[model samples]
Target: MKFNESLFDNEQTRKEFLQTTSALLISLSALSLLHCSEEAPQKPSKNLNWITTKPEKRPVMNVAYSPTRILLKNGIIIDGSGKPPFTGDVMINGSTIEIITPKQINFKGTTIDCTDKIIAPGFIDAHSHLDWILPLDGHPELKNPFMEQGITTTVTGNCGYGVAGFMPKSKYLAFIKNIGKGFFSGDSSTQKDKFVQKLAVSLTSMQQYLSYCRQHGIPMNMANLAGHGTTRMSLRGYESKPLDKDEMKTMLYHLEQAMDEGAYGVSFGLQYEPGIFATNDEIAEIAKLVKKKDKIVTCHMKAYSALSGTYPLKPFGTPHNIIAINEMIDIAKQTDIRLQLSHLIFVGTKTWKTCPQALSIIDKAIDSGLDVQFDTYAYHCGTSVINVFFPSSFLAQTPQIYEDKVALLKLRAQLELIVALLGFGYNDIQIINANNPELAKFNGK
Candidate 1:
């Protein structure tokens, strides 16, 4: 059920799932290419002394390194500031690049011989889901997938599904239980249910998560966005309903806390559950809070379903891509918040041919004084939850509630709609994986 490219490139897949996209093209001739060390350098542990003592006394690394002079000789340097490549020697004093010149420099400490290799600043992964990936995989010391690719920093917690605040234990239990039903599986059974069950229970807040990363020694730096979906879940428990005044206040408080703790901004996965239930006004209210902090707002707009003309199931004209974009633009216009359109891409035949028109819309927005930006990958296929196409009514019910006769009948109807919306035969609907013994046989059929 995954739309390979869409899901991977989508904003908050990390909250529900993680995706991998293979780049098919490389711009080797580009003047600026990222280069990084093979591994992270060793630094004295700062928090080890407080491990068993008062946790409040634990020291976290928050300062830059003192000046240390090192020189690189004879390298092709491309300073990522869009400058042309030049052959030179670069000097580093402490954390800053002191100079880059063609002249030879006599220096103390280490001098690396770089006759052909490119020297450039580390790459910044503008978006990622490492917040959930690192904790789940327990590989903070070796974030090699990114490190090896020259990625020196990552901004995570995108798509309103961050791991910042805590959820009530009961809600956490229910969420975990629901995912175990294999509703989240991908190309394989994944058995994420077993993994989720085994995950250490202490990962409840963003601060604690970051502390874990620092304690484990992450190879790269990390930043975060407060997740709107997680906040909604914490308050409403996937009820698929609007928030009352008090609930909204609580959510705002959580967002404020996350921002004070260093969240760069906020994110929304309006295409998914909880967020899907959020009204335009509700989204605006949240974005207003983000604007108060003078931070950006990222959104996975409620566009695709509306564009496909399959959603608003009973109520047509429920804001498609153009409307969704306008809504975000309007929010930004009203609040003066920077807007980031997460993983912008055109989907389906209905929208694919209109790529030029889409770009024109964005261009017009920029011309109109709106601060808008977007990110995308070269891949075409996207991935998403198989149940995404399922109607909201079916989604609102808990897995336990779906075992009844009426619920089973509803499930059949929902499946039929999904098939019709897909407008494809069984061959196109390849079975990725299924937990049910009866359904597993259809894998790859």
Candidate 2:
């Protein structure tokens, strides 16, 4: 056909136009695909990639091996006994404290002159969950942060999340298998099945991790608490059900085993799943076991609010937060077991003002000769697995309105900072396992 000059383009020009048109079409198609993909529902990955291929090994860092001994000159020592601070020169040989003298000691090793600084036996975090939530490889840095905060020793894996070495192999395998299934399943039934499977696996895995720690010299000394929720989940499925006599027996046996394995005590996160389902009688039974072993019973009490109506049970009634605390108190009173009420501030809600009242009760119990100790964190608001938001009380009652403005503001700022830094918007940033290489890799960048 006799075409216009414009239509009768050269072969090269025609090819170029065709290529450009194709490229434009492909780009448009890709944009559409991207939009659709964004809108599409997410499916569980068939292949669970939670376990990273490259296992995390400790990074190489500078370690100073002293030729002889080190002397810390003119330092104030707080011996962690809540005693008076003393000023003196302390000499250290290897890991042992050699001597504390008013006069300086001649030593060949490194000398840290802490004239103005407070020299204390590292700070002890009596109750912390650093083991699970903290990045494994970042442990050194994480530990440094704690050290910077003057915390030398941290009691991790509390609230039924025992440390690595405490869990057994059979339980570990079961937990892994169950978690694997959960990673693939979608239906409620599958989820239920996976939950049961995972509970068993977790219990066994915890045992294995504990054993591993024993085999290798533990980097830092850790005291564990047998998680009541994990034990109950292992015995009973994820569905809320009463534990049978046999299951209770199994639970007690596991608790005893954990105690034998050098666990400090038993802990319960009664506010969380599985724990919420646990009855007072069930907890009492566990308390009895702990008492028999002369160990402590630490509980994360359910509700800590003035809105008593929110909880179906009345204040201090059955299943009430106060009731749970009282139950542990009763156990201590009856059996004389040490009882530690964990994180009083976070759970206290607006009752922060009323914490003194609660403490008074504990102090009274102590005065009456019942062993009881309670802990409060430096920060007012607390962080947990469920959510990252500040305590409802903090949001509900502003410092301008509340009587405790300074405390509330300090807590609020800390919570805000943590939320901002951690990108609390990202839901997937959960700390699953200690050996979770994905999080531990790249210096936790």
lDDT of each: 0.60, 0.52
TM-score of each: 0.69, 0.61
Worst 10 residues of 2 by lDDT: 26-35
What clash pairs does model 1 have?
3-382, 3-383, 4-381, 4-382, 4-383, 5-381, 5-382, 6-382, 7-383, 164-206
Once model 1 is optimally superposed onto the true structure by TM-score, how far is the C-alpha of residue 361 displaced, in angstroms?
A: 1.9
Model 2, CA-based lDDT: 0.52
Clashes of 2: 22
In candidate 2, what are the lDDT values of residues 1-445, reduced to their tens digit?
A: 1112332233325344323222222111111100113355577553423222111321222224466677786666666676555555677877898776544455556888886555677667788765432323233543566667776556765665443322244333344333333222212343443233333345354455456445643345566677776666555434456788987887788888877776777888766555666777888888889988988888776654432222342333332344446666776777777788887642322333454666677878989998788887653334443211234333234323234545434543544443343222222222322122222331212
lDDT of candidate 1 over 1-445, digit per residue (tens):
3233332232433322211111111101111111113456688654433212232332332222334767776676777988666656777887888777655666656678876666889988877766655544443343666788788888887777766664545355355334323322331333353334432245545566567667766557888888888767777668877889998888888788778777888999877677777888888898888888999888887764324322444323432556667777887778777889887765543344456656777888889998899886544444444444445555666454444545544544554443354332222333444434444554443
Candidate 2 lDDT for residue 71: 76
- Global Cα RMSD, each model: 13.8, 20.3
lDDT of 1 at 78: 74
